[model samples]
Target: MEKTDFDTLIERSKNIRTAYHQLELQHHGSKWTIEEDTLAFLTDAGLVGRNTMSQQGRWPKTETDAELKHKLGECVWWLTVIADRMNIDIKDAVEHFLTKTENLLEK
Candidate 1:
């Protein structure tokens, strides 16, 4: 497997979100409010959890790793979408979170 940088991953994720939005934008007719987006993001996150369970054979909804992997990717899409809509960078957010957390623990 090849490794990708965070920027590339974020960019690719944003591109996919754009493509998907193009398909459904007309139906939504406008962007959702932050609250709505947050709910949607959480829903996507729950789906990811379910996909993880499936991958682990814990009452799986999906029959294959491929399906689970696709769901996992969809979760990443939600993460990127939520961050984009909220005017945040996921890479920066995670890095800042980790640095803060580790520093706090060390002190």
Candidate 2:
């Protein structure tokens, strides 16, 4: 397949979300609240409970390297949808964020 642009990915993500929503509606379900969806998205991405280290005093028993990798991909998909919905150029947004962070770290 050919490579796709950020805008294309965003459009595709919207389509996927629409289909997911339709399935929920068909099953007499409700849309996920923003918070719920966000949590769900993060959990699915393996970024929630799979922390490599425990902040409270111990290391995590379960390894999450694979889960974290998968979740990062999912996060990119979610981000594309959000950026598209907001009419933002995700590519530019990412660049701007990186640039800002780099400049801040240089201080």
- What's the TM-score of each model vs. the native? 0.71, 0.61
- Each prediction's whole-model lDDT (CA): 0.76, 0.69
* Candidate 1, superposed: residue stretches over 4 Å from native: 32-34, 60-64
TM-score, cand. 2 = 0.61
After the best TM-score superposition of candidate 2, give how far the Cα of residue 50 lies from its true spot, in angstroms.
Answer: 4.0
Q: Which candidate is the best by TM-score?
A: 1
- For 1-107, candidate 2 gives per-residue lDDT tens digits of 59988677877888997887788778867865556556666666555334434333355555566665666667887777656556778889999999999999999
In terms of lDDT, model 1 sits at 0.76
lDDT for position 33 in model 2: 52
Window of ten residues with lowest summed lDDT in model 2: 48-57
